[model samples]
Target: MKFVCYTDWNQLPESANALFLQAEKDSLFFSRPWFENVATALNDDETMALACVVAGSKVMAILPLMKSAGNIGYALKHRYTPLYSLLLAKDDQQQVLACLVEGLHQLPLEALLLEPVADKDGHLEGLQGSMQAAGFGCDRLFRFYNWFLRVQGQSYAEYMAARPAKLRNTISRKKRKLEREHGYDIHLFSGDDVPHKMPDYYAVYSASWKANEQYAGFVDTMVARFSKAGWSRLAILYIKEQPVAAQLWFVGHGKASIFRLAYDKAWKPYSPGSILTSFLMEYVIDTDKVEEIDFLTGNDAYKQDWMSDRRERFALSCVKSVKPAGWYERFVASLKRILKKQ
Candidate 1:
């Protein structure tokens, strides 16, 4: 087995592309297009690199890495990224992970930071173990909470019926009130119409309570690319032709991820966000028939009302103690831990 790092996406071998295709079957976040968008939109001072573990002509694993501050590395991720991890081929996953861990040591990195990794999969756990076995000091830090719903073969009506009575009533009452007061319309755009409807989405988001997007054009470009791939589920709620709420969702591999959601503060009293969510939920459950719905990040109380289960996301910080820089990082980490304990 050999370890190879490619700085340019175009320089990646065909074998690597095949591995990415296999990974995409698991989550849209692992798809090449998603990674490309992240690279192009999120990159600032960091230099992106694709680290791979190859056995002959076959690629075993691919780690999306960003080199920053000369010797420190991080996952190629941004605030918009809900989950991040190394993409590995199916067969011999343990072996491939070990090889990948070994390959990571070949880089000039003293410390590597991987964040917002889902805890459901054993991949990150295996990676932690492998890094420890490779003589690296690893720390697992809590990042955020992820709420998700498992459809479990239930119809949309059945699913709604099981939700909390208060939630059901609120959605029903608010939706009715909003429609009666302003004649609201909810539109789900997935394909050719997504690009054209982006202006409405931007308008609603800008008027919402959330802060402006740190990376300009990131969400727009992502929605456009995912729309072209037939993975977008952009929903907009309009009251008399003015957008009041907008949500960007992606449906792929039997799962729907709620990527971005915002509602005009002016319409918050009418609960346009919740109403739009309810509409999107019904569509995904009854029409798209997705097996799972993920509320990707955050522990907001409202998420629990819609989601059935909660999972934790964590950051894996690894330090190569043999290097002086790594030793300094370890000292700082140890000091922080001690202070927290106190």
Candidate 2:
């Protein structure tokens, strides 16, 4: 196998295209479209590239990477990205990962940082082993918790019936009160309609309690791209013909992920967010019939009420011992660990 790096998407070989097509069957985030949007939307001081390990005409593995202005390397990710991982072929996983690691080592970087990696399938463990064998000092640090639900072939009604009584009651009561007091409508946009409804989404987001987005056009770009790919599930709640709440979801590969959500703070008393969530949940469960529903990247109390299982995301930090920057980083990390223990 030989290592090859591509700084531009157009330079990718046909084998790279074939690899992504196969990988995306497991998760939409593994697709080229998703990474392309992320690379385009990020407005940071970093140079993005794709590092690959290829064997003749076949691509064995790929890693999306970015080199920071500070000379450190990181996974090419955006604030909105929930999970990131190395894309490796099913055969010779360890060998492929090792080759990819060798490629990463060739870059002029002092250290490598990757975050929000899902480890349920042992990918994290595999990566750690490869890095350690390559003589890098690595640490696995906790990032955040992820919540999800397994549909298990249940109908929407059956799933709702199994939810907590208080949650069910609140959804029913709040929805009715909101409708009776000030008539409301919930619309789910997908495919062709998504572009037209984006303005409403922006309005609702701006008025919501969350802080302003750091990257200006990231969400808009992602929504447009996902919509064109038939993976968007954007829902807006309107009261008196004005958008009061919005939620962005993506459905693909038998899974639905709740990507972003916000509600007008003025409507907090009416619980518009919860009411809208209920509506979207029903649609995904009954209409889309997804096998799993992911409430990605959080430990908010409300997430527990809606999700049946929990998992953790972690970051892997690897430092090169021979580099001055890496040595300083190692020292700082050691100090921090000692302080935490104290």
Candidate 3:
């Protein structure tokens, strides 16, 4: 196996793109345009160095990575890029994983930080073992559950019937109360209209609880790229013609992800967010024709109420043996140990 490092987005070989696309999952996040957009938006101090594992003429696997300098070999990861692992073929998992581990050892980073890794397979375990064997220690920062609802072969009525009775009744009550106070309106936008409606979505987002959260600009960049490819889905819910709740969904490859959402806090008493989600689920299943909907991020009550099952996501930190990096790692480990004792 031959390992190649890519410093520029254009330097990525076409075969690597094809190999990633053939993967059953995480294909959208690892796509060519997505990688380019992420590299384009990299911070000044960071540099892109994507690694690819090749066997003869065929690209076997790809790892999305970035580099930076720190007291140790700490690296910064893109927040919006939730999942990262070796995108490889299923048939050659052993060989691909071995090559990937070897390539990872060659990276200049002292510690690799990756989060929300959807370890549907045992890849994370394999990576950890490889890193440990190479004289590195693996630490987990945290883990969260990812919610998703499969809508295939189920009508809106059938799906609602399967939901918890209390949740159903709560949604019904909220819908009725909200409609009685001020009639509601729902608008679905896609294609060219999606980008045109981003300002409207942002207006609602700024008023919601997450208004102080940074990365609106990053969201815009993603929206622009996704919109250009007709992968953007925006759903707005208005009360008395005033926008009260909105959700920005990114749909592709038969799956729709609820990328971001917000609702007017004043309507919290009436649960406008829940009402909008209920309405949108029906549309997402019947109109949008997606097989499943991913409520990306969070293990909030609302997500549990709506989603059928969840996948586990993890944050992995692997520290290699470099003097500066080792010192930094030991200091952090000691600090955490002391805090836990208290």
Candidate 4:
């Protein structure tokens, strides 16, 4: 297999081909644009992308990683984390993962650290072995759920009926109340509309994150990067003259990725967040563009009602070069082991 390291998505091919063909059907998160757009957004940071191709022709495996200084770099004195690096490929996940691990060792690096992997139910088997075979071990660093709302192949009525009776009642009541008490209107920012209106969306994102004592987690940069790469779009929920909540999602990758969320505190009781999500779900079903949506890697009550299926993700970290010398590194490994207990 020919290993190709690309600077950006433009260099990647259009078809799933040999390596990515399975990924095209199995995973929305592994799509080429998802990696390219996010990597480009984090361009200011130290990140590298490598694609594995078989015999210099077809794409076989894809890996995306960012240099978080907290991880152990080429030298052991400093620590860094390569955030959200993942393997994207199809068929025989075990073999695909094994190949990725072997390829990683060949690259120049100290260690690899991935966080916020989704805790899906079932299907997380043998991933540790793949990483170990590649020179890394498994660890549970952090937990999150990628929420999704099932779309495509279902009518709006059929979709709404699938929810629990209480959920349906609540949603209907809330939608009505929202219309009665406040003239709330929902707006969608398709990938095409993102560039022209993102600045305004960014403002709401910044304010919402700041109020929550956080930033939008690199969202503004990520959106600009994805939108420019022609991978995704921004959806904003506007109330009168102001923006209440905004979501950035992917359209190119078959699994629409829920990348960002920013909301106004004033509309908390009105549940603008859920309302905006419902709007997008409808849009997806109506457009029939994709079969599923990945709220990627997080489990929150607000985001769960719409999810049709659950997936468990495993994080494996290993280094063949040196056993970590520091107590903290050992402590992290210990913590990883401890997570299974919880």
Q: Residue by residue across 148-208, what tens digits does model 3's lDDT show?
A: 9988678788889998999899999988887788788889888778878887787787788
Model 4: per-residue lDDT, tens digit, 1-342?
A: 545666555676654334443443455344443454455444354655553433345555555555544453211001111123344444555555565566666767556544434454122334446656555544554443345666656776688788777777776787899889877777776555787777666767666634532334444545565676566666787767688877777665455766667787767787777777777767766674666777665567756677787555445344453564574476556546644554
> What C-alpha lDDT values do all the predictions have?
0.84, 0.83, 0.73, 0.57
Name the candidate that leads on lDDT.
1
TM-score, candidate 4, is 0.67
lDDT of 2 by residue, 190-282 (tens): 996887787888788889988875554777777777888899998999998999999989998889999888999999989999999988999
Clashing residue pairs in candidate 2, if any? none
Q: Kindly indicate the candidate among 1 and 3 with the higher lDDT.
A: 1
Q: What TM-score, over all chains together, does every model reach?
A: 0.92, 0.91, 0.84, 0.67
Q: Sort every candidate by lDDT, greatest first.
A: 1, 2, 3, 4
Indicate whether candidate 1 or candidate 2 has the larger lDDT. Answer: 1
Q: What value does the lDDT take at residue 282 in candidate 2? A: 94
Candidate 3 overall Cα lDDT vs. reference?
0.73
